[model samples]
Target: MAIDRATAALLGGALGDALGMPTQLLTPEEIDRTYGFVDRFVAPSDDHPVSRGLPAGAITDDTEQTLLLGRVLLESGAVFDHRRWVDALVSWEREVKARGSYDLLGPSTKRALDAINAGASPEDAGRGGDTNGAAMRIAPVGIVMPFEPLEALVAKVAETCSATHNTPIAIATASAVAAAVSCGVAGGNWREAVDCAEHAALRGANLGDGSARADVARLIRDARDLVRGRPEAEAIPLIVERIGTGVAAAESVPAAFAVLELAAGDPWRAAVVGANLGGDTDTIGAIAAGMAGACAGMASLPAGRIAELKGLDVEAVRLLAAELVAARFDRPDGRVAA
Candidate 1:
């Protein structure tokens, strides 16, 4: 049986998040010294008390936040429901606080959610945030609304992102990611997906000098050119530096795309290449992995990488994926189409 698109996206994202958790901070050299290339997901570092060396398969805030947003979307069934989004954020904050999880909430998300709880307008809540939280949890939107009109999908992404990231660049990056994922789900070729993403991003925010969109686009083109005949090990470093692995959407998004483009046939390698890039590895890996996973499906993912996601809520990911597929492809007849 063919795996549904939504499940494919969710599982892909979760697996990437889990696999990159342990190597989130280490640079290529540090990762090599500490974990040595990280082919298989392993437990977190013993030095980090909070994570307490979380087992190999443990996921981080990336997956958790994405899943939470997916639930909100599934529950609401309407695009851009502010009340539902507020409730979801509140509930997520409470859950994380109750669990004593420190890193589960992004700074921008926390600030915006706090502002919303304090009676700030949703439009104003995220004005101070210029972070990538909006981009990180946006994959589900792509999965659910893949075939919707571009204007509608872009509007939904803007509405959702405005709660924690209203900056022009942030909005652009988020829209680009959602559009790219949607293109992938729609079975467009990689070049087509990238083109859609570029157009969507340009519509949302101009690609100014030093902007994330410009940087990511440059990286994508360069990586594609460099990887034509080079081995992954040689090409990955160049891509990472050009694109970066920082929290900025420009850095992370492009880096993720580079991994996907370079490792087109291997989802596992794509994710690891993202993780080993050092800063913000988990988010980068998560974003890249989501796209790669959607394009390649579960079968293309390595057994070792899938095995590493052991403790993650796989069933939840699967359920979210199924729901997104239903929302995107399934009509009343119970069949999926483009």
Candidate 2:
């Protein structure tokens, strides 16, 4: 039997995280000098900030935060409890510190936490955030809300996004990623999935409580276009050239889509190319890998990388899949057509 969407998506993301951890902040030149086109997961350097001294296959904050959202999804069932979920993130960071791990929290999230500590409400805590953190863990939201009406999906996704990174672009970006995952689970082809994602993102852009540039949607569209018809080897520099791989939702989210387009929905290649993309690799890799894996299922994922995954909650993901499948809200019967 094939690996289910949940398992494939989560494990695929973990593979990307492990593969990218060693080169998290380095330039392509630095990465090439240290490992020469890394084909395998390697241990992080002690000088590394977040993942130092970890085992070869250890995952980082990307996978860990994904798991945190997975747990929140399981605990809350189909409801999007904004307060509980954000609180759990703060708690998760504390746990990371308690364990003596140095996996850094992103700027938007750290600011939100500081806001909360300063007596701001969770709902108010992330009003100013505009980073990729909101999009990073949003796969769980899409998993449970599969098949919902497009408007409703976008609205709910934006509401969830409000817990952190609440700018219009941030909300739209997360919705796009989640929308793609939902489309993939419904068995849509890659182009169809991407098209659906753009629609959801556009719809989501109007629903958030935060401020954002009016041109963000156009920027994302431009970034997404860079991957179409381009050779995989040429796509990365072009992506870095224009799309960027920074922490801002606009930069990182579009970079993720470029990977998806480059891979043509191949989970393994998406992960590999994402790892080599040279900035914000793990999150971008996870975003693309999750969408690709959801569409391809476990059987189509690269066997070698899946075998190399370590420290992932494989059993938990399997269990979560059963619940998400049962809770699926909506999908047209002809979902493959987008």
lDDT of 2: 0.75
For candidate 1, list the clashing residue pairs, or say none.
6-321, 7-321, 57-308, 212-250
Over 1-338, each residue of candidate 2 has an lDDT whose tens digit, in order, gives: 12387667777778777788887777666777776776678877778767677888778788888778766665664456777787898788788878777346888888887788678888787787788887877876666665457866676677676767777778888888888887877777667778778887877788666555544456657776877888867887888878888888888888888888888888878878877878788788888888888777888677776666777766777777666555564234312111
lDDT of 1 by residue, 1-338 (tens): 12454566666777777777777756788777877887667777787434554777788788888888877777765545768787888887888787777665777888888898899988788775666788888988777775356666677677777778877677777777788778777776556776777667766664222233343345446556755566778877876666567776766776777777777635567677777777777777787777766666667666555655765666767776777777665544211233
Worst 10 residues of 2 by lDDT: 329-338
Return the lDDT, model 1, position 3: 43
Top candidate (lDDT): 2
Candidate 2 Cα misplacement greater than 4 A, ranges: 1-3, 214-217, 329-338
Off by over 4 Å in 1: 1-3, 206-229, 329-338
Error of 2 at 26 (Å): 1.3
Best by TM-score: 2
RMSD of 2: 3.7
